[model samples]
Target chain A: MRTLYQFHGGVHPAEHKQESSAHPIVMAPLPTQLIVPLQQHIGQRAKPLVQIGDRVLKGQMIGQADGATSCAVHAPTSGSVSAIEMMPMPHPSSLPDLCISITPDGADEWITRTALDYQNMNPGEVRNRLRDFGLAGLGGAVFPSHVKLNPGKLDKVPTLILNGAECEPWITCDDLLMRERAAEIIAGAKIMQYLLSADAVLIGIEDNKPQAIAAMRAACAATGFEVIAVPTRYPSGGAKQLTKILTGKEPPSGGRSTDIGVQIFNVATAYSVARAVLHGEPMISRIVTVTGNVEQPRNYEVLLGTPVKELVALTGKQRNDTQSYIMGGPMMGFALPTDNVPVIKASNCLIASSPSLFPAPPPALPCIRCTQCAQACPVNLQPQDLYWFSRGREFGKAQEYNLFDCIECGCCDYVCPSHIPLVQYYRFAKSEIWAREREKQQADLARERHEFRLARIEREKKERADKLAAKTQGSKAPAANADIDPKKAAIQAAIERAKLKRSGVTPKNVENLSVETLKEIDEIEARRTQLKQAMEKQSDSPK
Target chain B: MSTALLIMIGLALFLGLVLGYAAIKFKVAESPLVQKIDAILPQTQCGQCGFPGCKPYATAIASGEADINQCPPGGEEGIHKLAELLGVDPKPLNAEHGVPKPKSVAVIDEELCIGCTLCIQACPVDAILGAAKHMHTVIAKECTGCELCIPPCPVDCIQMQVVQEDLTTWKSKYPLHEIRNV
Candidate 1:
């Protein structure tokens, strides 16, 4: 038996896996309309290739990937673009995003498909093809996987970890996936290993998921892949924790697993990769565990953009006390604003939340400083300290405690005897810091623009002066063009003449000058001082 | 003992010479006080503070000629920031200047605009793009919601529209969790 490693600060939350893991995955029926958001993962939103009223085929690329950090969006089925407008997204903030609403024609067609022999193609081509296919990390994070696949500037990676440790309670999507599509997961791992040129491939499934382990082990019989059943612990499925458990080394603080010569992918992500690369299918659906408060707590291969209400309808009846739906696991998931919102790429679990099923947490008490929260923090951060700092709005002190490193896994909340929502504090603090950073950037941009404008105004004034001087010289030979302009420069010099003649200006040329000339000189004198100030500003700005 | 005292005096003189030279070498031309005040002020360039722009207002504040609560776009938060930096007690925002409004960008109705280039001159940040006889459009990102161009428009074409909180601009609201550690 290969020696397994241990990660600090883990809790064995009650595994309610039996509710959903008992049944096999089933395909959800297609909806009448699909609202596809153009954003993929974290970077720039994808640009729409098809206009409204354009016909789209199944697996057709509708939204083009924007940059190296983004991925494409494909048509879920044969449809015509009805509208491209802002629609509510299935996110905690309940904000609307630009979405392509397609009315399906029900032909259920496919674009011309060709399998990729990844072995024959270069690894870069394979990764790029996967990006165009819109393959992202399906296990909750929805980050574009192509960026992770490229081991840039690193020696041959040593370990490839497939996280089959679906450790969140009441969520069995990954377990069900490993049980059924174990071969696909193995194939995907082999492909990733080839790309990474990794020395070892390890798939770590939690010990609680016995059937998934057996299925995965049987599939890996001659594949040179090792299947290890790690001790079931909550948040072991977290990439950092899983990476640490599979390999003794931890990725550096404020860094990715790739930094430590290891790259981890969720098992569901691996299955999607295999389907996309080998079968040439785009990401259109994911296995969601519709578990809480339903008659049949089962897993379904839910098509992206299917309403949560429709999927909940397939689960038979729900308890009357079902107040809301919480997307993802109870620990890290947020309460969905409405069942009307369509499921997106990262939604792995949808729990019909009710007070009785998962009883309402009682009113919280004051912290007694028991250190239970600190003990249960998977990242080994001082949760109590973070909580105090965050509550007081002392962001700098919280950052001093390394606030950004927190994954908001809710392990601290789970173990808090005082029932404090530790994760929420961390989340609020993180968002506050991010907002401040954005504000600082905006301030800097505004300053730069204001300075640039000031400089340009000065340059324009100088150009105007030079032009006026040139015109006066040019016109002096024509018809004494010196009448208006040199008259202006002559006035510009008279301002300093004003300071000298403070007590009394003895009128020498005043008798000969016309009334219009005197008025023009007064106006020009005012402008000359303004122009001098503008010139001074040109030298003041640094950039 | 006299020789030791002479050596100490010589050492002190040498160190003082180095210190004096270093001060002259690394001398900063101006205090950063005005720059810090400017950063706290929102660059609205609305001229509600009786100054031409945020930089002018900042310069006045640093010289103690202007009060700290003159900005409306910066709001009470700006007042507090200025107070903290200058070591003075924070005061209520000066409502006489103008009431604070939600962050918004100016939108021009193209049909109503007469291409007069008046609003373009009024804009401090130069966010408005237009030629003398062409339709003017506001660059939404560059706009600071200053409302400076509104009065200058001849045709009443420009309108201040609030920037709604969408996904890109949305913030996770506070007090989301019931369990406050305090």
Candidate 2:
């Protein structure tokens, strides 16, 4: 017997598994119209490949995987695409997203599928094949499984933990899956083990479901895989907690299980992988536990994009006392804003809420800081401090206290004597942090572009100034030459007079002058003659 | 006694020299006050704070020539941040400046735009991209939601549109039960 290790803090919520797990899994009838959301998983939204009026077969890829971290979307049944537009999604925010509405042709036709011999094929090829098959973690996170399989840069994965511990109350999709399809799930686990090259495979199912444990143990008996029954604790099924229980290692904060040489996948996800690899069937349906307030509470193999209202109608009529419907487990699930939203890959259970099942939490009172919340925190964080910081909108302090490390399992909220709705506050704080981070990124980009604009404007201004200076210089050169032209003309006239005097040419006007003018001219001539005689005497003396 | 006193004085002088050297050696180069203030202000550069851009406003605040509450884009939160950095009491946003409103980006009606380049020159962030006598378009991501370009639009084709919250930008303000009675 392998000894199990313990985590810091946990709570024991009511299992509530018997309501749905008693019956075998039943295939839900295909709806008339299927509203498949383009963004059913995390990361980038898939791009739609089909247009309205196009025909599609069952399991046909309708939305193509966009980026490395995204997965594709497939048609749940043979159908004709009707409308592809923004429709309300099954989200806590109740926001509208692009969805492809399909009208089934009742033929239930399927596209051609060829099963691959994964053992003989290269591991990378197998992973790529799985990528387009629309396989993701069905364990509420809906993270692309192919991305998780690579374990990037890590040479080896020591252990692969398969989570069958449906710890949250009123959620038994995994339990029912294990009970009914244990052999298939084991086959899927083997495929995953082969892909990861993990040394050991451990399937950790909570002890609350003894039947599931027994079935899984029997299926994995002759195989190297071990089905370990962990203690039934709320959130023991959490990836990190289950890893710790089975392997005695805690994944570091904000790090992945792959960092600790371990990786976890939901049993349903493993089953989907088995189907994708061995049977070449894309993920189009999942076992969803539809219970609470309905006449017939059972697990249904619901097709993706089936309306929640239609699925709830299958479990008999909802009681008059039923107030609302929650999409996942009681602890982690949120109430569906409307029943018109379609079920996606991540939805595991739908609980028809009633007053008795979930009484309205009383008005919140002031915190006395009794530390009960801290004791119940599975992550071992100070819940009271986070609560105070979140309330005061002191995001920096909240972040310093490691607010993002919170798994939001509602352990703190369950134990809070003050009824503070602690998880809601944590969610609020997280959203605010994300919003601010986005804002900061935008501001940084804006700042860069603004600075670039300023530099360009400055360069343009300088260029304009240089061009203007050049033009002015070009115009001023002619004006400067005009001023120099008069000086040149005066110099030219002086040279002409000197040339005329050397030639000894006397004008007729000078000879016809009056007697007084002649006398003046004779006096001038005598002076000029004397000047010439002086110049000649000076030149003769130098010789 | 005199010899002991002289020795103590010499020791004191030696320690003072070491301490002064350490202070100079490990001194941190502080970022200038203007840069720090500029970081807190939203870089809208709308000139609503009576300055050319966020940097000039930051310079004015650092020089004590402008009040901390003058920025409407930063709003009350901006004032609080400035106050915390300057060690002064936070004051409400000055009403003489524009009132705090939802973030908006200017949208140009391309058909109505007569290719006038006035809005491009008026835009402090230069988010508008167009030439004279050509259709101008706003780079939505680069736009700082500053309304500086509205007045310079010759054909009155510019309009300030509030940014709509889509799924990407939407955050659940509160749980449904808390918001609605049901």
**TM-score of each model, paired residue for residue:** 0.86, 0.85
Instruction: Kindly report which residue stretches of model 2 are placed more than 4 angstroms away from their true locations once superposed.
Output: A471-543, B1-31, B174-182
| Model 2 accuracy (lDDT, Cα) | 0.90
Q: In model 1, what is the error at residue B133, expressed in angstroms?
A: 2.6
Give the local distance difference test score of model 1.
0.87
Error of 1 at A124 (Å): 1.8
What does DockQ give for each predicted structure? 0.28, 0.29
lDDT of 1 at A419: 83
List ranges where model 1 is wrong by over 4 Å.
A475-543, B1-29, B176-182
Q: In order, what are the TM-scores of chain A for the candidates?
A: 0.86, 0.86
Model 1 residue A396 CA deviation (Å) reads 2.3
lDDT of 1 at B17: 100
lDDT tens digits, residues A102-165, model 2? 9999999999988889999988888888889999999999999999888567766889999998
